[model samples]
Target: MSSDELTGASEKKGFSTRKAFIFAAIGSAVGLGNIWRFPYVAYEGGGGAFVIPYLVALLFAGIPLLFLDYAMGHRYRGSAPLAFRRVSRYGEWFGWWQVLITVVIGIYYPAIIAWAIRYTGFSIDKAWGDDPEKFLFGSFLQAAKTPGPTFDVVPGVLVPMIIVWTITLGVLAMGVQGGIGRTAVIFIPVLVIAFGALVVVALTLPGATTGLNALFTPEWGALGDPSVWVSAFGQIFFSLSVGFGIMITYASYVGRKTDLTGSGSVVAFSNSGFELFAGIGVFAVLGFLATNTGQPVGEVVADGIGLAFVAFPAILNEAPAGVLLGLLFFGSLVVAGLTSLISVVEVGISAIRDKTGVGRVAGTMILGLPMAVVSCVLLGTTGGVFVLDTMDNFINSFGILFVAALSMLALAWVWKRLPGLAEHVNAHSSIKLLGWWRWLVALVVPAVLLVMLVLELRKNLAEPYEGYPAELLGVFGWGIVIAIPFLAMLLSLLPWQRGVDLEDPGSDQLDHADRTDEGSLR
Candidate 1:
């Protein structure tokens, strides 16, 4: 039985078409990272030359993992946990690991969205006035002087967080097609237009060419650096929303007989394209800021929060027609973030629906309301800046990379499911494959992830992460990541509800581990 069958068959939900699935997947992929992360990562990695390693990672690591996820969720014809259960009873914990990672992300992800929503309004009035860093850290966030937990709610952050959750969970309650699919179809194009217009406006600024040159100038030596390659892979993996449960859950909604590989290819390219476009727009604005202020592009370039919140506001304060630029830029962030947040929340909701055999709306409320409340309580306080920063770093480094690598290694070697998955993809996909994909998933991807993991651990060990207090890092950083898998395991031990599907969806009802000898791994 499916989630559909677990309830009434007639009440089951999915994207109405492959096109809808593609849009939803793209919406998931083209997110805040594309807007704020890619530019600086690209410029730092090797400027124009970063494209080579990025493309290599995309073809080798990014798209391959995406197809691996599609095969798991679509072929097993279930939610991440349900599908992995079909793979092998032992494999269910891995799915829960992925789902829990999303739960962790879902808790804090909307706070950033809330910030963006508030900033969109701030754009109209040049709200940050003089010092954006001071304004953001002091006035808007009311950040504590040091890193520690606090419960004093910042009303500014809380209201917008409530608003963000209301819109997000509200859409989710309408079921997959009515809500997720439609929002993607509508929001993605609007995102393109909004950001595209921003790009045009950014390019028209006086120093736009200077920023483009800085971004496109090839530092040939960067290609030789091992870390550059790693950054390329990291950006692709993060920007594509692969490895995490987002792609897997979204792929589960795609209709049968759809060309899964073809869809993956489209999504992969569209995501890359959007980010590159974003890099242009972002760097272009940075260039204007640099030239206008008589600074080098390198001096002006920043990444992540610093780029989005700090530097961008400074540009808006000085740039020509600064108000319009602020609207387009911040509005784009709002639109982009909401789409990705929906998918992050969906992964946990889908798993809950599968576990309890609840209908979509009920399952959404069961999990969604609490997640919203926690987001408000934790991230809408003075200490939120400290906790959110630590959690995001620890989770992205230790949490996501750890689960992705463990799941891939387990599914490929222990469960011996790659051949079956490849067969499933080849059956339904227009793009056929040989055995190399199996080898890539089995060996190469995990190797890259583990290497990245080791590097992160070493760097964190070398110094306290971002100079936060040891106790804070221990609780919110190391402690939470340490807790996730143990929690997932305990959750797995709880029996799935009676009506949820537990049988294999493949043609023959055989344990995937038993199929290891099948035709040389397909």
Candidate 2:
């Protein structure tokens, strides 16, 4: 039976409208990374020089892969797990592993979102002075360095995590249109407008050059290092959320016969544009602050979470309308984090709904409850925080790679047995695939992913940057980073051995079941 039939025909409503899908894509792409990770990577990779590789990666690798994903999802008309299984009978089990990565991301991601929410709330409390950085830095570090109810168990972090998760779960429980899809359309644009305004204001701030110089003045020599390439590839993968199976799940919602190539292109372009602008805005502001305060660039860089927690609060406290600016910056962050978290949760939600007969609400709560527990534990232990960070980075960076590989293999090799595969991919595509595009998918994409996997391994195995930890956790983290996609590919071949019908969506008929009948507790 088709997914429509499996849901007893009630779930056969048309897919998300174009505008809604676009909004969701933007929401997924513009997250904490745009504000936090992009600036740091840009500065570390030699400013302007980093821009070249970033743009190159986006154009050649990111965009094409996005189009590829859209095509695959639209063709199968199912979630990632079912979609891949539809492509090849053997690849059915690989979907859960992809979902697993998203679950790991969801665990730590909310904690960060909670931090943003807490910061935004602090803006309203007026607890911060014109020179809040002093208090912000001291408080956070003191809390990290010291153990007591004052910092570790403080409501500042814990409350926000709970609240953010509550709101996120509530929205998700509402389903796509009432929940995920609708909320995205509203917040994604607001996020962009707020971020754009903050950038404009940040540029005008006094002594902003320190941040700009550190971000834009590229040391060309740095580009030659192999690590730079690896970083670029890693950024491309993570920024697009390519390998995580998230995109595939999202694209599955697109209406049948939608222009996969055009929609994918728009999403990729929008995402890359957000990252680029954010890099310029954030680093420039930080550069200015560093120069004016006479603080070393290295110091600012070392304080990863502290950049948002300490530095930005300090910078805002000094501005003319500092509190308002803080509100905008952190408010946008809250929205961004929420949108990203939605995507992360959806990956697992899709899996549970498919593999079992669980409703979306039950799946989301089942998935989220454990994360809440983990976050609470992380709050209690310093080492737990590092472990969470490592898991997120390793899974996001390498996990997605494996997902992407499995996806490509399914479409290119496994799905070749399907009837009219090319015709299905091109059904609603605006630009017809040329003969060359087929070869590119069959050869080029897989080759690029393989090369990236090797480079990532070499770089991780090489000496850690000065002062960086080289312990067992760190090494294990690196290993996971290298193993995620490779293992994904290996796992993609499993379902076939179990005698599952991987070539048809009917194999997972329950995936399309509506949870509304399960009651709210679901």
Candidate 3:
């Protein structure tokens, strides 16, 4: 019997419309990474030349894998755990591994959002004042004197973190369509508009063209470097938000008739488009900073937290209407971060709901509240920034990439589901997946990911990441990475709760039943 039949058809939940799914999916894809990470990677990789490899990776690896994720979830009509369980009992463990990585992400992700919130207020008066780096590390984060573990909580960070949790949990409590969907509909448009305005303002700045030129100037020689191609692939993989369970979970809620290929393309391109837009705004501001400071753009340009908090704030200190510009920039971060946070939290929420048959409220409270508490307590501390940075590195490098590569291997080789999934995607999607696409997903994507995994592992084994103490990196970084898959396997051994089945819930039967029910209503 289908999960709908087993749990009662009335209980299944989904987005109210196709647009809701698209908006929410795009919201998940566009996050702080787009705003901060991509521009620097593009600049460093090969300037304008990076776009060549980025587009290639997107076509060969990113979109194909995205299609696989969407088809799996939409076909099974369940989140990652349940969706993979429908494939095979062992496959369920992989899904749980993804969930655990997302859980780790959930714990610290909000803390950064909380930082963005505090910075938003600071933007009002250029409060970071003079030495922006000192203000961020010393005044705001109150970063630990040493890299070793410490529990000193920064009140400035904790207070906003509470508010962040309250808002996220409240929205999630409203159920998928009413809460997540509605928020996406409202926030995405505002995010786009807000950033659009920032771009307009940025272009009018004196150094805008200089920044644009720096961004787009192609260094033809850089293309030949294998590392540059690897960087491009890595950027696309991370930027697209694949290999994590977010796409799979979001796709699970999509309507049966939704076009998987078309939707995946929209989400992928929308994410890339935003990255390009953000790069323009970011580099434009950087150009102004370099011009004013009598430094080159390369010296002023940075990425990750440094770019968002340090470099940008320093520029704002010198810009006209600096305070107003600050608000728009930080406000954009909060909106982008919140949307991604919702999706990350939803991965765990949907997994719990699938496993135990709990409603949204119960699931959100059970998982969300604890995560919020942990986020507040741990990230609230002085050493919190160090810890957050460590966790993020390990999770992305080992956690996400490992799960993604494993997933492709399982679907293509073990289950042999790729051909069928391609058929499912092509049935509804305007863009059809042909024979070669299967080889790309099966061979090309996994090979590239494996290379990335091996290279990262070799690097980490050689030395502690970023020169942090080995003990700290071992516990928070490598420890968590190693633990996820083992824990997932352990969890898989537990007997599934009653009403959840181990067998595939036949899609044909579910579709027929839905049609019959609709006919009766007519």
Candidate 4:
């Protein structure tokens, strides 16, 4: 490890504060996935029973693994590769795959963000009444949500996507304090307050009781299904911001005295809190509305486009108050997506910055421009979005599992086992694990990951899905997933006999020398 990192500090100039950390992590964790993805997954997973697996996964898998990432980052105090090197030289090779995944995700995710932005903006003027879906085909998502002769490709989608990307790049290029930290400080709390308000309103709706009961009640049968456990584990891992190298890279920028374990706890819980809260908000509003309309909960739950794009606009048409709430909710989603997207871009940008010594502005554009073009194309074709969808599945199923497994192995076995590993983790922890937690990490987490990997691989082999067409695109999609680790291994072949030299050796001292007491990120 470099002298700066071993000393447990970050470079002061672009370092993050506890509050900044909280907002940034929240910003990273709470995304359309929270508002858009989780509700659907929860309903599909087992309704109220889903919470059981989710919480269990959080206890056994998410929190400990998060601390592992933070510890690795703080322990190494550099980019992802440098952090992995602290564990072992071979491990640094594993880090590159993570970097690659982040790069690909950064390239594709803007399309989703662009879509969300378009939907949000669409709600602003041309009010589509209670059944917005009726008008949507003739209006918004003209190609996908409702397709017909009205589908004429235009610069509308691409223009807004570019604007969003440009704005995000500008903030990132401004450096952490002026850019990332500042935006988080302002936006994260606003998101919490706004979403919290939405939840309160959602609960007051007509069928809220059914929604709340559905969300909170436990169905014991779900506990028996292996898929439930797998879903829960996936949610925790994805929501807690692990496996993306985002947390690792972000933690590298935090100060030494920050209490990584404690901070990690706050981040993990804060992430889960938003998800649980958002689920309640979505299901409650939909449930109440469904009851009034006498629609089945299953149909209501399947109202994917309806809830966000259709029913939400309908709610606003009936009550302008809902329009305001809709704005806040979608606004929060936009912020969350941006935060995660920024982290994704930064991973690749950091790699380029380290190797080429390029300016952040130049690096960002170099990484972003091509990705923006790709996102535009994805938005253009019926099959275009397939690459992104396949990429998401490939990474979530294989890439994340591979990294999580490797990370556990490195920490639990290769790094001299858990007793000492636990000490390193609990070094500055206010909530230290006893002994059982160590055994769990060494045994349980890895086993769970292996089972998940096996199931995913089997599912792919047995139920190979062909989304859209264009075999070349399918190949590109799967290729990126496999390429991540494959390239990482190739990069690891380089000799690093001189220990590891960080891109910022002076970072730790700079971080330590500027220490100040601050509250946790939550």
Residues 80-167, candidate 1: write the lDDT tens digits. 7877888889888888888888888888988898899888899999899899999999999999988877998999999999999999
The lDDT of model 3 is 0.85
lDDT digits (tens) for residues 1-522 of candidate 4: 454553332344445567787677767777667787787778777878887788889999888777767766665555576567655666777777788778777766776677567766665763565557776544444455322112235465567678778877887777655677788788778878888888888788777778667666667787898888887887787777786687877776676667777878888888888888888888777767667767766665643344666666665554435666667666766777788887777776655544344666776777777766666666544433445566677777888887878777776777754564456556667878677677767788888888899998887766554533345334655566667777888865665423325432333343432211110110
RMSD of each: 4.8, 5.3, 3.3, 5.2
Task: Report the Cα lDDT for residue 412, model 3.
Answer: 95
At residue 471, give the lDDT of candidate 4: 56
The reply for model 1, stretches above 4 Å from the true place, is 1-12, 507-522
C-alpha lDDT of residue 112 in model 2:
74
> Where is the poorest 10-residue window by lDDT in model 1?
513-522
Cα-based TM-score, every candidate: 0.95, 0.81, 0.95, 0.85
Number of clashes in model 2? 13
Q: Assess each prediction's global lDDT (C-alpha) against the native.
A: 0.86, 0.66, 0.85, 0.68
The TM-score obtained by model 1 is: 0.95
Candidate 3, run of 10 with poorest lDDT: 513-522
TM-score pick, better of 1 and 4: 1
